[model samples]
Target: LAKTTQPISMDSYEGQEVNITCSHNNIATNDYITWYQQFPSQGPRFIIQGYKTKVTNEVASLFIPADRKSSTLSLPRVSLSDTAVYYCLVGEVGDMRFGAGTRLTVKP
Candidate 1:
């Protein structure tokens, strides 16, 4: 499993763009970067994923550089309801480990 490093907390205003970056210095070539968003009392949901370069979905975007040592999760036009924890994971299927996540607070 690849260890991930991310901020403990972040803040953003309504309608603002929020970017949370995760570092995985020891990622393997077969690993993929996956991001998940979790609201209070709810399970974490998948946001975006990429092996290299960028992948965008209706909810968020994931950016991975050529080296794939790090990734960024970009959330556009966030609202108060978007306040939650964000997790960055690097692994192949069935080899992921969930650790502490980045807490995002979206204010009005």
Candidate 2:
């Protein structure tokens, strides 16, 4: 499994776009980049996943460079309700693990 690095906390105002980057220096070819978002007292929910290039959905977009050493999660026009902890994970099926996530605070 590849270790992940992300900010301990981040602050944003309502209606602002936010981008969180995670680094995985030892990422392997079989490893995929996955992100999850968790609200207070709730389980984390999958946000996005990617092997390389970009992947997008209704909630967010994931960007992975060719080297696959790092990735970014992009949220558009976040609201106060969007405040949550974001986790970045890198691994293959049986080796997946979650790291200390980035806390995002969205203010009104």
Candidate 3:
């Protein structure tokens, strides 16, 4: 499994967009960039993922650079209820490990 490094925190106001980028220069060939969003006491929820290019769903958009060394998760129109921790992990589902994540503060 490849290790990922990203921000420890980010701040934004309600109705604003937030984009978080992660760097994994040592990302493995079989590894995938996955983003998770965690509310205070709850477990993280899958936000988006991609090995390359872009992927967008109901919640957010994932943008992976061509080199595969970095990726970004874009949240459209965040709200105070969106305050949470965001994590970027690189690896297979079962092979991944959780670490202290970036705490995101969405102000009203």
The local lDDT score (0 to 100) that residue 4 gets in candidate 3 is 78
What value of lDDT does candidate 1 attain over all alpha carbons? 0.90
Predicted candidate 2 versus true structure: per-residue lDDT over 5-99, tens digit per residue: 99999999999999999999999878888899999999999999999999999999998988888899999999999999999998875776777
Task: Give the alpha-carbon lDDT of every model.
Answer: 0.90, 0.91, 0.87
Candidate 1 ranges beyond 4 A from true positions: none
Which has the better TM-score: candidate 2, or candidate 3? Answer: 2
lDDT of 1 at 77: 100
| Counted clashes in each candidate structure | 0, 0, 0
The true-versus-predicted C-alpha distance at residue 8 of model 1, in Å, is 0.6
Work out how many backbone clashes candidate 3 has.
Answer: 0
Query: Considering only N, C-alpha and C atoms within 3 Å, which residue pairs clash in candidate 1?
Result: none
The TM-score of predicted model 2 comes to 0.95
lDDT of 3 by residue, 1-108 (tens): 677788889999999999988888888988888899899788889888888999999999999988999999999999999899989998987777666668889998
How many clashes does the backbone of model 1 have?
Answer: 0
Residue-level lDDT for 94 in candidate 3? 78
Which window of ten consecutive residues has the lowest lDDT sum in model 2?
91-100
